[model samples]
Target: MANNPNENEQAQIIHWADMTADRIIKQKGDKGQYVLASGITPSGVVHFGNFRETITVDFVARALRARGKKVRFIFSWDDYDTFRKIPANMPKQEELKKYLFQPIVDTPDPFERDESYAAHHEKNYEAQLEKVGIEVEAIYQAKKYRKGDYKEQIKLALTKRQAIVDILNKYRAEPLEDSWMPLNIYCSKCNRDKTDHIKWDGQWEISYTCELCGHQGSENLQTTSRAKLPWRVDWPMRWVFEGVDFEPGGKDHSSDGGSYTTAQEIVKEVFGGTPPVYLQYDFVSIKGRGGKMSSSKGDLVTVNDVLNIYEPEMVRWIFASYKSNVDFAISFDLDVIKTYEDFDRQERLAYGLEEGNDKKVAMAKRVIELSQIGPMPTVCPFQPSFRHLCNVLQINDGDIKKTRVFYAKDIKNERDERRFQERSRCALHWLKNEAPDEFKFTLNRTRPALDLTKAQTDFLNNLHAFLEKEWDNLKSDKELHEKLYEVIHSVPEFEPMMGFTTLYQILISREKGPKLASFILAIGKERVLGLLRP
Candidate 1:
């Protein structure tokens, strides 16, 4: 185990786990066993922001395993926390309002069928992790850990409680407002914890009445205890109790001189134990949408929402492309298409399908393989923008006509079938949202009566004659536009620009759209001359 490995040193570090394991071994010697942990309070729908912590931990855990290190990754649900105010979107707010101060584990599952509310939220997030290939042993705090699994550690802190209290009191006295209560106990009666304060009076202490519920009784903090250690002590206490080696958390806990730092001190002081190695991850910011994706705010985009537009591999690539410190953005717009294009290009370079001058190609290839996509395509040449694909699909009635025809005609290109399928789904979603009206062509029943004045009639006749004669010779869109403008300019009877506009409107309106010159040729010179005969 050594200090942080350089890029040159990175090559020597073959697997991510080996790099992490080496670091752990350096810190704790050969006896160090690596473990990963991510904890969440199931206060709302588990949004993508919450999932970031899970994925971050999973990446490290997988990397450790790749390095031939034994890794145990566990997730803890903070279900024992009292239910706060009912979230706004909750269907039955009034009914559940009564359970606000009780442990979430004791509340009935909002969905009714689930065993408990905590279980319902836990299952929802667990399902998402499974979908994203994130694996972890789940530890439910309310059930397993809180039922005296950590009783010895809890009692140790309780006996040495004065020391913990002194630290908190000292913190509170400081001008920086760094202090917090050492214990958070929910009264079995009024159920509120924050508003109530406890005062120790020798062997016996009197409990104050809750201002809201007005329920009061005499109680003992040292005896008949139903409280957990405060967050600062609880965090490090868990590390000591579980013998955890590594864990990642949001900046709130991991910030400079924050709870994590303070907890490290308490762990060594009260428990006489070493704390785990900590990686502080920053928040992922979404584009166009201000602020982080939050479950409580109900402003979150779920993992399922993202999977609709992108392949799982591409989504993972988006995460792996950046280091944890940088804040990033994800959009469901044309930008998503650009991301896919970038992923495809990188995938090609990695597999030697495309010539590239950079050694990063090997790293890209490693990511591609890790993401589990098959070998790169050999003959598939076209890579359209997501917006372009959407437009094409829209014009083809969501049929993806060009891709389907290409695949059908090229039997040898069958190796790229899966790539086409994945892209087609992305195209379908773009078409559905962005260009629904143009996805399919349909004809109208009746044509509008053309009531042109004498000058307008003559211009139409001249335009028809010009198109019929030069239709076959026309080569490009620019050429066709120039030809149409020439007719409009020479014929004083038509307002040149208006003539081109009218012709375009008529063609699209009549034929559901027509090839510029071909439709003029099809309608014929004699019919055009007669229709314009004012």
Candidate 2:
């Protein structure tokens, strides 16, 4: 295989993120502190598509801190926004219907929790992020708005309304009407913000007639926190308020004439602030790269779902190794096992357990470095292939000790033992739920279900004797595998594959399975002898 950053190289290499951070620091002119910000609207159950933004900023923040820069990582949840549609996972859909088009903070929780609807989703979102070891200063947009933190920005946007509209119109095929206003206000009486008759009093208040409830009233700009700027304006407005040095947006927002384009223009023209350094990350899909996954469409996966089967580091590796610009999938089927195998091989090559080319090794090492959720491991732990784990787990009936002995032969240290135990738990859950039929196996407890031919019978008898004589000599799965290959190929009456198939049928009552020698070793010599003898 290819190796990265060969051991002999002396030149320093700058990672992509490091280069970007350096530029950002220079652009900001050595501000005493930099803020790395990423936010998502908690409209419903936030899915992995949402996580792309969260993890992208997280990786960049870590990269910046590694260079001795001070960074405050902030995660904002736009929970104050209205509840437009019901999420599939949330309960009380009928009860929640009444809150449609109302600010999420004003709506009651669907589950009868004391918290509002937005708070409920925020709690769930933070819990999943915790599992992945991402720590950030979580801010709720609803709370910030209600506290009147954006009052000054709201006034400025109203004053510069025409400039903001002109910038927005440049990209829109349909320009806004002359009467267009950049703000929405929650009606004082009805709580719904549906109003087209809004007129700014040119000072600290705005008059409006609620279209939904028909209550006419004026809200004080300095006192009432119900006024909110439109999304395009709000996005850039926050960029200035938070002093964000870097942030990431989804491809949908980053496209030409999209929210980002308008926001960029608004930030420069109306807000009089420079937009932050931005990275446009692509979407995640279930059908692999380029396939789109959407929360609103009910096509989604959560971080908890991914972490249920994958080790946290492996989960981080998927996002860390793949550049943010490329689309990827979080597969849950048999292919996931292959993904784990690839991660393990890359890890070995990165940590120098296996030798390879230099440049490839360096790049691989960087990936492992960034993918770490906590402190990086000092020594590479024993990595067992997910497929091998599944098979051995079946043979041992999910006994961690026997499986560890079978795979590791002996514990290398405390770290290796802990890793083995953790991996076993993840593998068992995957086998029970996600593993495909071909990967599933059940050892037969009754007599062998086979009509053995004379040649097959002869092959089995000879193999049993061969294994018994070499049992004490075989100290590892590798040695037993070589012996099994020699004996099976030596018999002309039985083809090599057919000989292995006969053993599987006798031992597992199946025509196919894991390597016969290794499976026998995991099941123990006495068990195999008793099953094969007589």
Candidate 3:
């Protein structure tokens, strides 16, 4: 990730989304609308790791629309996939364990909320997506399969089983058995995919014996939902079925022997549809936690988790800021302050409110264009200092109302006020939960009695007098800072560092803390005078 926020304008900037859209337009030719596709199996919670895939598609869809192309975003929920393992995060682990090998849509919700376990995760994530401004024509695989919407495709996969096997064999190090079929089935009796001895007639009927319950049954592909195609075959089949112009895959599927490679050949050779233009995306890791997260392991963060700490636009910025192939971490650590600062700087440069390298400014325009949750506001959005907000929120003891009042004058419009309120919530949440210990503290109710050095005591007396006399005249942090510096330097041989250290110790009982000037103003001059009184 060679992402330099301060990259010089002479640097050539090529946004990945624009490149992908261009490739699709060139490869597929312009049509009335482009169908962009993404999907995942709802076997476990759809954590933030999985979000990289969908948000990648969302970015390209936005880019395509930016190029005057109509775009339809389709997100398929592969709910008909089997419940290979229960997620560690879900409730009722023992209750869920029994449903293993069953289609996820057939498994009952352990929470007993939605009709099925798959629906529980699916619906929750859908709501989370809307918060981040992603809308999709959701395709539920279970319903489509049950309604026989893919009847002709199902028969086609069966008819082309040998060709599908040959395509898959090209990627397998060891050869697949000649009898391997391109399909899978849940037993009619047991409703589990623990079936063996699968045989498909030359026509529409398929028979399989349940290895679990020992029941042998045959069902017509036209009428039964028990049969489904394997992943490699199913993916390309749907690409043709939906006329997808562009789709993106994770690194796993983009490798030489991966699903996307084989599916490209299979779609052309077996189903006779051209594969969609594809981009290979990398994984997103949680900061300080190495490696990709697993929903099955229940150690992953969700979109909701990210949204808890980030404003909606900030969430959009995290993904849009980087190319899909670039691996990045979502930090909940001190790096969070830098993340907010970076976003603010980009927003400033994009609105021409600040100057920057030409390349970065150009990149900021498109990136922020994609980052927005609504239409681009004519004026720049609010760019509050997240670090300052953290300090102010602590001064107000996490009371958002009081915190909002403190920044009320800085805000000029309803949008800025809304931003203040939202970012205040994020700042407060960070301070309470994710911030470093030194970054968090409340104002001392009463002054602390410390054995002060004569030099430190002399500086504090001067500082106290300066605040008392000039507090009412100090209009901004910068002005207050300059006047306070005069008081410290005026004392003979009093080091500026010593004066700052004494002030911090007297205020927060620490040698280091937030930017001093604004922090004092945020604390109010009268309160500082009370604390400085010896």
Candidate 4:
């Protein structure tokens, strides 16, 4: 087995999501009619980790469509599920405690913006999902349940309750009790599903007593809207009900005897439907956050926060460019600049402006294609390195126009202009919040803090004279940079770094700074000469 991807890899390396989609198409046998489904409980603030699920389905759906297979990408909000816990950020905790056992869709929105608590959260993330270019049919589980859309499925689940219990027992160490029902019934009087005791009144009505409030009521399984299947039964029921062809889940659900396993069996045996193809994706953790995120806790890096930092394309690239099962950390510090650089490098390779292996080029191209949230310019926008942009902004003291003029010599059109401005804003934010100490530097104004030797002084004077003569005809920063290298090598006593050190001491009274040539160019030739000359 080859350990490296580029080594001994074939001409075309299939992307993991594409491969999964392909298998789904072949198994389902309807290339033109396939549904890819993913859902999240709108129980709290949507976190960045939730994006893994959204983007996973989005990529696979896009890949399927790219192959001329029609796909209906559906994102379901499981809001009909009972509100089990109080979120950390929710206001009116005492007021909300009474509504805990009811469906989130029934609970009033604490913010009073939307119709219900679930609608409030769903509407927020719905806008965010649109921003990231996820074109999916957003389904609210409460509406579907209340409208009796899952009436047949609910009835079927009730009939096959014994079979579901048997299936769940296979994945559990201890057997389920004889009284365990696959469905939960809310009390008709209290509208709360946290009922401990339930009695089947044969065929249609089921009586339940709410454990939380001790409210007792009976509901007709045929006409009443007080029943919901538990997650283990509900998951597979939905898979069969919606005809889901493909879905991906986190590592925990993919573990042995996890909920997915139990659901798989229920779908196969009880629902009499083949389970959708499963892709087990890894978790995304923040650098300082100790473990995986639970959005309800409210300590999270939201998807919108990440979008504010990274371009939409680069944000999509983070997931599309990697294998699903490989765990990755999202660092907020200096690594963000490196991450942007990596994305740009891969993009260049994909566009054939840079050299890479055939398989790598193909993979890169596909990653970029899927990474886009919307159409991009035909010619890639010229971008200075993110690190360079950061330092140049600081050097210019956040004068965006001055920094842009210094960094980008040719702004082709509005697109290039817009891209440059956007990148500058992102870089400025990163520097202000997440940049590490090593990358931070301030240009010295008043000098004379250096103990320069006679030889170093002579070298600085000579380099100054050299720059005065050659700076004008020097077309670019690259040309000036090369010229600096030539001048240093001509004096065999000085090393490459020593040349930079000499320049830094004279100009900024520091040991090091930005690339000498670019820094000098950005500072303007006249300003640099004034500082360097005696």
Candidate 5:
């Protein structure tokens, strides 16, 4: 269980500004300034799985800045990477394949006829990061670094191209056998760089064909090489070109002898600079029947899906709740409901509306710490239950503001309010799947239908009468339970315990529920009698 030193500090961990300053001091050792960099490819809608890396890098950046160190945090979008394939559930399928080799920034939006698909994906993710409080100077790879902005480095790579090939050979890895192209070959057909055959003729001649498109090209091995560098070289090359100090990547690249290791060596050898410190983050698995959310699989749960159910802050809390290496699970279940409730309870305590227990205080601190961001908009007033608000307004024919305020006051805490809001939004879901018209309220536990004997029917009638007459007198749970028990005891034909079981079965279909007395009180004696009458 390795812990992050920044988070596990014994004393009050200083602010993010202070942390950044401290890291800068240590990394530079009295040097001038340092820059932090992170990047992601806009291949698909940015899912929580993809966010693991982005959030980890953002946290590191924040930590560095907190320490009074000058830091430049840059987030690069690898939009120039070719579109891979049309994901499932995307509105258009075969139509999008035409742009497979083009940069993602040049692709058309699947949903819209006019907008480029790359812009569509980029716009959504930019908004998501804003919601999550991640601020970074964005660089689009297609625009910023394209047209050979890294021409010098590319030239260096070409000069030491043989050296890189020698290193690959040392590792027993064979270079692509084609002769007309440079060592690195990016297929114009697939838009992906994984191609075959890089054959070298004499000192300055090589060629390769796109394994995907079969398009072939030749270039001088000297300065006229048109092939892109392999990822193993490209990644470290960027670290040197951009002066990246720290960047976090997925565990795949962070493995014991993965590309990052090779890239680090190439960065030192080719670019004469050390690669950035790397933090490896784990995957996020979605709960229920769906497979693990994946951008490549096109079965991803995007940040928008979470925002639909949770506030921006709660979403941030999820990112901060666990360390980078530990995989975590998110469910649309009772557990999620409980988490929202707990967050609300803690929030109430923090705001001084309730008695704060130590646990509540700690939870409150966690929520606030994770959600720290710029000032929240005044326009986005907390709406506890979107469905409830919609329903109350729909039924009463009133403004949403009135309903929001009413529900807000009743919520007791922020987390509970959020839970109720989510549940409310799911009202239509439960109604469609679980609820029955015969009973307006769905029973948590279903009871099988039972035949009522003559004696049972008569006893039920008497019980109903007793409840109808005593309904108003039953002011509390204790009073209701006592009256019901007394009536059962006085009935010679009815055993009190059996009668109680019969009553519970007719109502809840279970032998147990909330405190029986409290349950009856909450539903009211009249409703209970109506439910029990034969």
Candidate 6:
């Protein structure tokens, strides 16, 4: 993981974010201000698969600011992109088919809540980003285009049409014709891009015949509201438009002959602008679903879905913990519990409450610094075992308020109480929703008829007798745990597993559960002895 760093190694092993920021400043030169950009086409619901780009830029932006560099982080919603297909998850699938080939911004909202399909998806995601502490100057391509905001850029692209073709065809198996223009003109009449037989009249005027509605007209490229550059041209064109210093792309765009390859050439040769310092980020897959997520498929997790299980800080931690180029999975499976545990460990290291080698401490501090949303605490944040919360919440019958009351004595401060509240809510949600059956339990209403061996029966009987008589003497969970172990070894052939399983089955109707001694104490000595008595 190359996570830790020694004093000498700190300079050598910069965090991926700080390293990337350094590279950007070196490549672009130290300017008064720098622009970092990201974007996605709102063709459907924006899933966490797309959030990778947004968070990558945010990390770099923070790193740049840490070095006292002025940073402008902008995210674009390419809502003006064509609606090529109806996603399977959307409603009115059959009706939406008729809207294909139009701008996504112009399509009907399948959910019928927002102004258009693009706004519906875009607005929801913008709010989600704010929840996780990412702030960006959001540029909506549809609104910009409809307002003719990019007409000047469009005119520049039209002037370099042939040069753009030359760069693109360098990688294309077949050549693009000289007559090919660098723009798509949506038919102003039908408002659909289902048009062909185009002709560029050389200067700020292009004529096209609508294949769908049989309309023909010349659009003044100098003033038209429907002109759009192809992805390759638009990508570089915008780099110049916004003076972008850094941007990250997916593996699809970073390949040898991918959009980025040609875009770099087009930016330099055609647009006379340098390409941004670019990094290629790997894909995010769902655990147990070993494939890339697609918005069109809708079989993917969103940022909200993750937030439902993890606190806002933990959400940022998961993404910041990974290098941008490393592929990772978002787990809604058992790994969720471990993820929480790992973050809590990082918190301990960051606060110096837990000891680590210098390198480990440095890495943990950096990750915690990046992962935090508000001010860093002077002390260690309260550490809660996510697995314990699951057990405790279930033992409380999933009443979060009641569960909070149980942990109130342990919470010493306002911050710790908030931590407990957030974590318990997330834990209960997971236990009820995504947690696998093996991790879940319920107090048995009546004991299951168990065919217990004599040794198992004797172990339970002895433990029951001790708890019934000396329960008040047990001062702490750890002390009770040792006492339980002492009792288990007293009976001959009463293996530790045999005794533990016997008690678990009699109480929770499961062979496995939370740590037996701690869980028994949590269930209360009286309640547990009621089940264990012979």
TM-scores, all candidates, are 0.72, 0.93, 0.95, 0.90, 0.69, 0.94
lDDT of 1: 0.63
Residue 78 in candidate 5 has what lDDT? 76
List the lowest-lDDT window of 10 residues for candidate 4.
Answer: 1-10
lDDT for 466 in candidate 4 is 84
1-534, model 6: which lDDT tens digit per residue? 245545568774468899998999899998879899999999988999999999999989999999999999999999999999888888898889988999999898888899899999999999999988999999998878878877888878888777888788889999986657788889988888877777877677789989999999788876788889888888898999899899999998999989999989988987789999999999988784457687657576889988888998898888888888999988888999889888998889878888887767777888888887776677776776898888878988998887777677778887788788888888988887889898889977566788988888889899889999988888988998889889999998677888788888999988888898778877776678778877
lDDT of 3 at 264: 96
Residue range 220-320, candidate 3, lDDT tens digits: 98899888888888999999999989889998899997999999998998889999998889989888444668765767788988887889999999999
Query: Model 6, 20: alpha-carbon shift in Å?
Result: 1.4
RMSD of each: 7.7, 2.9, 3.2, 3.7, 7.0, 2.5
Q: Write the per-residue lDDT of candidate 1 for residues 250-340, one digit (tens) a residue.
A: 8877765677777877888899888777767778766534567766675666676666677666666666665666668876654665677
Candidate 4 TM-score, true structure as reference: 0.90
Candidate 1: where are CA atoms >4 Å away? 1-22, 28-33, 166-181, 190-225, 289-291, 373-388, 399-422, 433-534
Compared to the true structure, candidate 2 yields what TM-score? 0.93
Pairs with backbone N, CA or C atoms under 3 Å apart (clashes), candidate 6: 5-359
Best by TM-score: 3
Rank by TM-score (best first): 3, 6, 2, 4, 1, 5
Error of 4 at 210 (Å): 1.3
Q: What are the lDDT figures for the candidates, one per model?
A: 0.63, 0.81, 0.86, 0.80, 0.62, 0.86
lDDT, ranked from best to worst:
3, 6, 2, 4, 1, 5
- For candidate 6, the per-residue lDDT at 420 reads 89
Candidate 6 global CA lDDT score:
0.86
Comparing 1 and 5 by TM-score, which wins? 1
